[model samples]
Target: MSLVRRIMHQGFMPLFWLALLLSAALGLHQLETLFQWIQPDTRAVIYSRDSFLSLLLNHLSIVGIAALVSIVIGVGAAIAVSRPWGRDFLPLVSQVASIGQTFPPVAVLALSVPLFGFGAVPTMFALILYGLLPIVRNTLVGLRGIDSSVLEAARGVGMSSVQVLLQVELPLAMNVILAGIRTSVTINIATAAIGSTIGASTLGDPVISGLVNGNTAYVLQGAILIGLLAVTVDSLFERLQNSFSVMEDRLIK
Candidate 1:
């Protein structure tokens, strides 16, 4: 066990080191372009620093809001449909989530534009729709997967339904819930790039610009950065899930 722990620690150390190195490299590259943008005399390949920052902030905000909204609605929907009163509604909700996933983001934007107008509203709506399935489905799966014995025991102890859910089911199912949130967030990060198509500024701005101007370098830069960000966030969530799993294991033991 000590040897296994040592090996795992060694593996993690190098992995973290490499991630830090790559992050620093990307940061330096971004900084160099930023410095060039601010220098009036320097004509950089990228646009002005202010423009880049604005685009980045706009994209992040829209994506962040969309992901947040999706989490709340998706988790709520999951919990609702899990209960006996709402069980019959599960299929309908699942169908809706499926439809949302099947619908093209571009199509959602097109339809939403008429109702919500241009800018972030349409984009955010589309993102939330696109990002709901994993979270909702996972929540259902997690809740259902809980051991029946534990639940019965809780009920036998005179626990109310709410108490059983809060103290037993939810705690046991939290890792799965976190996993769903992680998946949703990562998917949103990628889908958020599509928001740029509807004039919602985001990291996708550079990639779109690159596509228009045939700037492979800029497209690569944007794509790589977005991929890296998604991977990092997903990894963080996986770690969190594992931590919860460990705690649950210890409790069970």
Candidate 2:
């Protein structure tokens, strides 16, 4: 039990990412051999050559950029709203985030396509918007929940406002902030699969192609890869949560 806990605290994100890459690059392409026997009637309509790897890479790249953007904006906004000078804007912030999420990713893409043209730009715009709400909400919740006395004590110690926030509050709130990030990233992973409709080249390529060509194999392949990717990243986030718990305990002690 202790050993398992230790490993969780060490973080499994790197391993999960590596395995996801290897499986998508090698395992995904070879899957047709096994799937062929199950659905002999349907022809494989997968990417030509090892283009599956390129598709997977492109998929990861776009999602990665979107998630990165979402985190920056979400976390920054949450921090600003949590502060004294920014408290009045909390409602405005909440409303904007709610509206961002309420607007469908497909609509965001469709509307953006006219301005940005078909490809990664529109898809990324959609993804960043789609991913923002959870991050901002979670961060705001975490910061709000921090013990007032903790901040008071930090301030009492002659620490400047910035020092208290960076050295004390941020660390204490990190786990909660990360939980919001996990939710943000997890939701975006599956949402990003649909980015292919706008030509962003993701695991959704097979799903879109399969639908167009009426080949279940293509759909299954895409779904399997995308599902695995989501699950793997979720596990990584779980590990990160565990790791932060351990770190938090150590800091408290």
Candidate 3:
């Protein structure tokens, strides 16, 4: 009963958002009347070049792949630099990550098209580059933010360096790290839409097509789905972060 109640509290918003996202992707054609009202002059209101569900899936795949790579590289770099031997390279790593973010996503895509050609590859590359900064920065902050006294205590209790890092530092820093990931993923979700311009199949296809053809309905559909996806992912991350915080508090008590 307690577990059920807890799941209900934590799962409701994410589930709601997920339901809306899925419905929009799978059942958007049902809203043709609404779209027609929005774009009365246009012959076709709902985007039909490709299915919304397909676009949504492709978008997720791009963002998911980019985010996975970003998390591994970001978290790994942060952990490495936090150690004694690697501390000297921290500034260089941070500067590189920041520079990666400074470049515009569109610019990166344009630059990548020649190298990678027009497809998901360039989009994923752009997303990975653009999404890296937040995760790396947040990871650095999280790992660096751990209390030195607590770390010393861990060592005092005869824990090795690896054990202290694994058992003490990572756990304490997880919430902040998760926040960084949340931000990165949210940013990638929106930016991934731009990839449609470069021939990447994403939810942004409708928006790009709508703009090119002056069809507002298509734009609205794409925007709605993209917005819903971002909200859903952010909410899920919030729940996870909250769970971590609760566990940390109980441990402290």
Candidate 4:
């Protein structure tokens, strides 16, 4: 298949999800009667405190920031510990990342609130902490998975350490690293919704409000959007991973 055609084919599903997500967010009020049925006793079936689009954007921003930070720190740490000179610290770094992952996101959020004081910052802080494990672990797996013979060959070819890492090691390990990123981001998307409980403006707001007010309609609305968003992102990552695999195959050939 032509590159353009292949690209389009791979992109189709994500585009479809994006369209559905937009339609649901924008046309939510049109389903008022349906929501009313879900929460028959509530005066307001629609979530009117904020638009779904705004909440979605806020949620994405929070996750995006956290994911970016996590990627940088996680990837960097893994790379550092993978180096010959840094090998002694590998166990320590892994332990730290594992501990961070073991910490409950809700507990992190609650703890950060006192320091960051109730906003997107604390939520992001919690997300970054919770999201690091997958990324760090995957990066380590990717880097360590490289064959020693490959590195020896690279060095024999007169490639500098940096050159081998940048040109060969990274290229080979990219897919695994990306898989980690996908896992981290997907988890963050779901966890970020919980930020609403701590005063962060997120899709979780409706769900929290719904629970507080005993309105199932509000809860359903938030859930639908969050689920759609997660699927969309996951689809996007899958497409990216496929593209990377194709490129790597081409390079190998």
Candidate 5:
């Protein structure tokens, strides 16, 4: 197939288009409301462009940083615990990640405020914690899911322990690991909205402000934007997972 055709067939295209449509539609709706509010005779309060942009940037930055941290920690921890010596520590790590997921994002933000102090720090911390579980769990599952015979074969072929893991196990387990990272990223995108609650500027700022002032339009705008972002990221991850799966299949064959 031609490159263009292959690109079109990939799942990410449709998702990207869908996200664009949603964003455009939502943005237009928001703009109309904003224009109406700006009229001198209108009773509604106007939302400034600066504030809106700041809120969006804050959210993007927080989610991006959180996902980055989660990837490093989650993947690193996963790799660590997959080894023989680290295997015994897996349950404890799993339990901790589970606790992170169970813990309220807001509560984490609140607790972290004192130590991390406002802005994006507390928000990033909460999101990192919230996003760790899926990646770590998936890493463990992926590494463990590798066929024992395959691992033994690699070792018998004179591959070192590290070589067996890096060259044999990890390649086979890439699909599951990518899937977990995708899940963690998408969840973090949604959860990052809570950052606005504790004085961290994010898409949630509009929603929270709208609630305070009883403005449904603003709330809807923020809600739509946040939802679109999450959908877009999720779709991208799905494509990545499919690609990884295909690679694993080809490797096995």
Candidate 6:
């Protein structure tokens, strides 16, 4: 299992990201010069101390945590609603998730600030709300779209409800669920930079600082890194979904 995981890690996804990584490497080398061009007209200050890797890692941690929260709640709520007893709550769950997202992330951050204080916590709360709708919507769609015959066959084999759900239904629906996650994480990667406004250290820190201080260089730096991070993660998720599809095909054969 460990060997399989290692192979999947090293051989599977990285192959898709080779070009993106190379581009980022090249961009990092010219990051300072790139900043100068962003505002040649203005006396923009470029602080070269913060490396792209450092900023990227900080951004990753913030978005990573919030995405985890989103997946747990979004997927769990969908699963619950798919169950017989919880089926009645499907509309309610869907509506509530819609409402949560309709409330702006900035507004959510403002509300959470009083309770959580100014930090990543409020930012994470806002993003968790932001990421919920797609995941829940997708999971519900995936589970509901499953073929009845397949489910009945599992049940005919004496599979318990739990076994059928865990071993059969979820595995079949895994790619759909993961697609939702892919969307959520990609969106969050760009959105979590807002956390910088409230004191969370992220790639957005430079952007916000630039906006406030009128230094276009900082904004350019943050924007480039955030865009690259989003692309990197989106590629990884795309590769993962492809891998799941291949695995599913193998099982069918």
Highest lDDT scorer: 4
The parts of candidate 3 lying over 4 Å away from their true place are 1-8
lDDT order of candidates, best first?
4, 3, 2, 6, 5, 1
Error of 5 at 89 (Å): 1.9
lDDT of 1 by residue, 1-253 (tens): 7434544454464456448535633463566555445443634545333354455566668777888888889888988998999999998887776665677656766787788887778888877877788788778888989889988999999999999888888888888888878777877777677777777777787678768866655565567656655665665565566667777898788
Q: Which residue pairs does candidate 5 place in steric collision?
A: none
Q: How many backbone clashes does candidate 6 have?
A: 0
TM per model? 0.79, 0.87, 0.93, 0.93, 0.84, 0.83
- The TM-score of candidate 4 is 0.93
lDDT of 2 by residue, 120-142 (tens): 88888877887888889878878
- Ranked by TM-score from best down, the candidates are 4, 3, 2, 5, 6, 1
lDDT of candidate 4 over 1-253, digit per residue (tens):
6655775686999899989999999998899999988788879999999999999999999999999999999898899999989999999988887777777777877898989988888899989988888999999989888899988989999999999999999998999999999999988898899889888899999999999989899999999999999999999888888988998899779
Predicted structure 1, TM vs. truth: 0.79
For all predictions, the C-alpha RMSD in Å is 5.6, 3.4, 2.1, 2.1, 3.6, 3.3
CA lDDT, candidate 5, residue 235: 71
Error of 4 at 164 (Å): 1.3
Model 5 Cα lDDT, one tens digit per residue, 1-253:
4434544577766567575845654454456656466443535544444355566666778888888888889888988986777889888997877776777666776888898887777878878887788889888888888889988889889999988878988788888888888877777776678777777778787678778877666676677777777776677667666766676677878
Task: Tell me the lDDT of model 3 at 201.
Answer: 96
Model 4 residue 118 CA deviation in Å: 1.2
TM-score of 2: 0.87
Query: Per-model C-alpha lDDT, please?
Result: 0.72, 0.79, 0.88, 0.90, 0.74, 0.77
Off by over 4 Å in 1: 1-43, 49-54, 98-100, 104-106
Instruction: Kindly report which residue pairs in candidate 6 clash with one another.
Output: none
lDDT of 6 by residue, 1-253 (tens): 8435744675544555655654663465465566567677665456454666676777788888888888898899999998999989999987776676677667766777788898878888778888888899888878987899999999999999999999989888988999989888877776778878887778888788888878877777677667767776786777677778888787668
Clashing residue pairs, candidate 1?
A: 59-202
